[model samples]
Target: MAAQSNAATAGTATVQGLLSELAALEDPQVRAVNERHGDDHGVNLGQLRAIAKRVKPQPALARELWATGDTAARLLSVLISRPKAFTAGELDAMVRQGPVPKVNDWLVNYVVKKSPHAQVLRPAWLADPDPVVAASGWALTSERVVKSPDGLDVDHLLAEIAEHMATAPQRLQWAMNHCLAQIGIELPEHRAQALDIGARLGVLKDHPTPPNCTSPYAPLWIKEILRRREAG
Candidate 1:
């Protein structure tokens, strides 16, 4: 009992210390900049990564940090947590929390993508009633479209994009657009159909992009990536 009490005390102190560190790192100016992009955190990603390096991987500690629900801390937790440790149900719960944009992006890329249950969860989440959860499912589908698409129904995916992408909620639309771009970039036989769908849908077609950066517009994005690959 004494040992358990002491261990709990130590864990509490550790989380508190990390929270203090994150607070110190926060900057009002950074917060303002991030808020424009729909992210609420103020700490720089590089600094968060550095902190993750200092903290040893501990799934319990990561869970505690995530439970704090502070964006910066949650980002750090993602960096240090063992991705495969989370069950499919836990991951589903996390996605439904509707974390701010950056947190959601990091959670999908850093943790959910690496989970052993990703494949099982993919189709289920894609069909979820919530747009955010459905967006996550689309994100995973985009990954498989590029990396491992043996059994994925390409025709069905394109048909869905044709039917829903133009009217999807903002985040879900973006994920569907990404999947459309990936299909064009990775699948030669389907390239014409992908390009035609992108041209007709015109999603993100005029979204401002910095000079020299590739546009997120699917047709343009697909073409630019193919150009780069050929140039290589």
Candidate 2:
């Protein structure tokens, strides 16, 4: 185990060094935008990705940065992290720490859902008491359903949306709403069910939408996205 111990030590030192390098590259303007998104460390995605490419994939670095680094560092850590390095327990703890929704979104999309560990955590997270965890679970599930809807019980997903979309916490309601939209866009047979659920919730129906973007009011968003997909 001496070789293993040495490797671990070297890994930690390397990641720590990279974190320092990353901190020096921070931008005040980017940090301002990040603060608006609920994380304060103002690092832009392009800069972080460039640095991540230099550091390459390092789960050890990712974990250390996430636990101790600033918001920008943590974002970079997630981008560089190996999906296999994060355990379900670790993810649970991180989610419970009340990370900003944007950070959680990236972590869920880029790390948790991409890992094999997702299958083990999905059910637990969907039913978790923490609203964020539950939201994340739904978000990940929506992605899965969109990518590969075959063999998945689309009926169950639609039923869940109908049951929870109306009353879920704000974050969770958004994810559930997205799930409904995904069903409508991706599953031809279940499009009607999804549209019906969207109609029932009417979630964000009155929310002002940007001029060039489709409204995220589920039914309209689903139709617009599907149309875009077909045109592409």
Q: What are the models' TM-scores?
A: 0.92, 0.84
Global Cα lDDT for candidate 1 = 0.87
Residue 77 CA displacement from its true place in model 1, Å:
1.2
Local error of candidate 2 at residue 64 (angstroms): 1.7
**Candidate 1: where are CA atoms >4 Å away?**
1-13
Query: Can you list the residue pairs that collide in candidate 1?
Result: none
Candidate 2 local lDDT, 1-232, one digit each (tens) = 3322322333343555655555666788887877776777655677677767766787776787788746666787788888888778988777776468667888898888888778778778888878899898888788888776666677877787788778887888888888888889888888887887888778899989989988999889988998888899
Best by lDDT: 1
Clashing pairs in 2: 31-42
Score each candidate by Cα lDDT: 0.87, 0.76
Model 2 clash tally, residue pairs: 1
- Candidate 2 residue 152 Cα shift, in angstroms, is 3.5
Off by over 4 Å in 2: 1-16, 230-232
Query: CA lDDT of 17 in candidate 1?
Result: 76
